[model samples]
Target: MSTYRLFDRRFIRHLAVLVSATVLCFSAAAQNVLRVATEGTYPPWSFKDAQGQLQGWDVDIANAICEKLKMKCEIAAQDWDGIIPGLLAQKYDAIVASMAITEERKKRVDFTNKYKSTISRFVAHKGTSPDVSPGALKGKTIGVQRGSIQAGYLTANYKDSDVKFYDTPQAAELDLVAGRVDYILGNMVTYYVGFMKRPEAKDFEFIGPNLQGGLLGDGNGIAVRKNSPELLAKLNGALAAIMADGTYDRITAKYFPFKLM
Candidate 1:
């Protein structure tokens, strides 16, 4: 070939190699397995079953969403205390565990449009003089799960009250049953699964208006890395599709008495 023709052919070959590399990079990204982190102790959101298998609303929903995305999903159980930091460190692709979207957390991560709403509920002893009213528990101590919406709510709204933070609802419930705390504060769904379902739960009752919106967050959404714009877009779109098709409502109904999604 002529010298000019040889130069053009080499340029075309180099360009082709560049294009192939780009395509391969894109394909690798598309096929990446999504890692979802959650606090497995939170019932109705994500909790271990009696057999020690991970089962709950968030688990089911995550599987469905992954199915829709046609991507493999790996659910990892992380301590609630470290969930946020772990996500920030890129330990997971998203947190599907009933994590609310809050301004404080938005600084560290992005969230999908809220797919569900949960009210913080208070469980108190039946016929107890002090009920679950926010004001009633002012002097009385209340047990709440640490690093949860219940603890956040109590700290923000009932600063004057004695708020006892426990590591988990199970621990908080023990204190509540032992009369160490007058009441227990947590999400309604968690209360239902962990406490309300127990035979001994008959001694307790849920009370107070559903605390909604604002500092509690617009509701629960999928949490993602702050810079994961493409992943966030894909997840948000998947959520929108599920919500629009009533799949979200169906899943909600299966696990909750009321429509949380």
Candidate 2:
């Protein structure tokens, strides 16, 4: 072979290798389709609609963030009890299920910056005593969803109260409305939609100050497996962009009664 032809052939092979490596990197990034886990039962954050389709603020936010990052986002339903375990096992890439960013949770998984704020609030019969404080539930049966922030708050604060934990907020709300429980504590937005604003909720009213900055943590955010900073950074970038462009506020206002931005 001619020396010139040999040189040309070597050049072509080098170019092919470089192009292959570049494509591999991009494929790795593009194939970064994030699998997000959510409590299939949390409403206003995530829940099944009348048609059995998953719908809620968290759903909307997930789709929007996926769109921004050009990721093939799959929102999967996992029980709240198993959500953290699922993420740890790589069953899902992240969680955007309105989970509070508590310090204890921080010890387990890395969370992005706060995307939404929530406070634990309680609902009691309309004519319930105004003096009922978080501490006043002592000996009284208070309802909370199992494995939730509200439960943690009650367990921590009202140790004397008989904490009745339910699997879902809807169940707790039902018992509360039926007078089976003294009160129910959960996310204000969920309580508002699932019980407070309902016709039957006319018999119930929200009580006490909004609980936050403590056991409730500093609001809700997306969570990823510990050490997944690359993925976390990507989500943070998309979230920051959306907030800066007012997309987050628009979504929040559409579903929430007040500004959750």
Candidate 3:
């Protein structure tokens, strides 16, 4: 072969090796990217704005955790019903949605330490002054989001009541406003952010004592796949760090008037 042709061939081989090394580097970097899923319909915790961008307490917290862990992060919006299944399918590395840490869910995915506690309450139209006890609420209509702890609680405790399950909290709240349901049970933070603060919801008031402990699960937690112990631990550590360093508090204060921890 001509000397010039031999030089060109050697240069091409060097370029090919360089391109292969670059591709491998990129693949390794991509592996470090953590994709987190959140139900962007649950406000105060997760929700989308008019512009269709996700923004809420959970979104901020997730970003903070990613910052602390020094990991490349991407947040994906998923419907509430598909969040868990999507996680199991490896569509995302973690679920930062305000998913309660319950025994039933634990069977499907491991959860990190409780990040925030949740309280459920019964909201009803003002002047009704309806009693909140199971016996008192019997024969009355109650709205709750389907597949939620609140739904499970009502189903288990208020079998006599006419319980209506909705796909989203907004739907339940709408039914309550329309007089289709006498009351609705949901997270206090969500109620306040999504409904209570609105002019239309001014007529609705929390009529019952706050519900917690049993059936509500311990608290809200980050859910990871069953086999991701290391990822879980790292997230837990990042959460603790954010809480200790006051990053968590700062984020919470922006969306909530009180501490969630």
Better of 1 and 3 by TM-score: 3
- TM-scores for candidates 1 onward, in order: 0.84, 0.87, 0.88
When summed lDDT is taken over every stretch of 10 residues in candidate 2, the lowest stretch is 129-138
Candidates 2 and 3 compared by TM-score, better number: 3
Worst lDDT run of 10 residues, candidate 3, spans 125-134
Alpha carbon lDDT at 231, candidate 3: 91
lDDT of 2 at 90: 88
- Model 3, position 179: C-alpha lDDT score: 89
Best-matching candidate per lDDT: 3
For candidate 1, the TM-score is 0.84
- Residue by residue across 1-261, what tens digits does model 1's lDDT show? 799999999999999999999999987985667889878987777888788888888988888889889888899888998999998887888999999887887888899888888777778887766445557667888888888866787888887689999888899998888889888878877787668889878789887667767777778889988788888999988888888898888888887777775
Tell me the tens digit of each residue's lDDT in model 3 across 123-241.
Answer: 99887665699999889999999889999899999999999999999999888888899999999888877799888798889887878877888999999999887898899999999
Query: Which residues of candidate 2, in runs, are more than 4 Å off?
Result: 1-30
Task: State the TM-score for model 2.
Answer: 0.87
Compare candidates 1 and 2 on TM-score and give the better one: 2
lDDT comparing candidate 1 with the true structure: 0.83
Q: Give the top-scoring candidate (TM-score).
A: 3
Put down candidate 2 lDDT per residue, 1-261, tens digits, no spaces: 999999999999999999999999987975668788888787778888788888888888998899899888888889988999999998989998999989989999999999988877878877777666646666788999998888888888887888899989989988987889998888887887667778888878988777787888898989999988788899999999889998898898888768874
Error of 1 at 198 (Å): 1.5
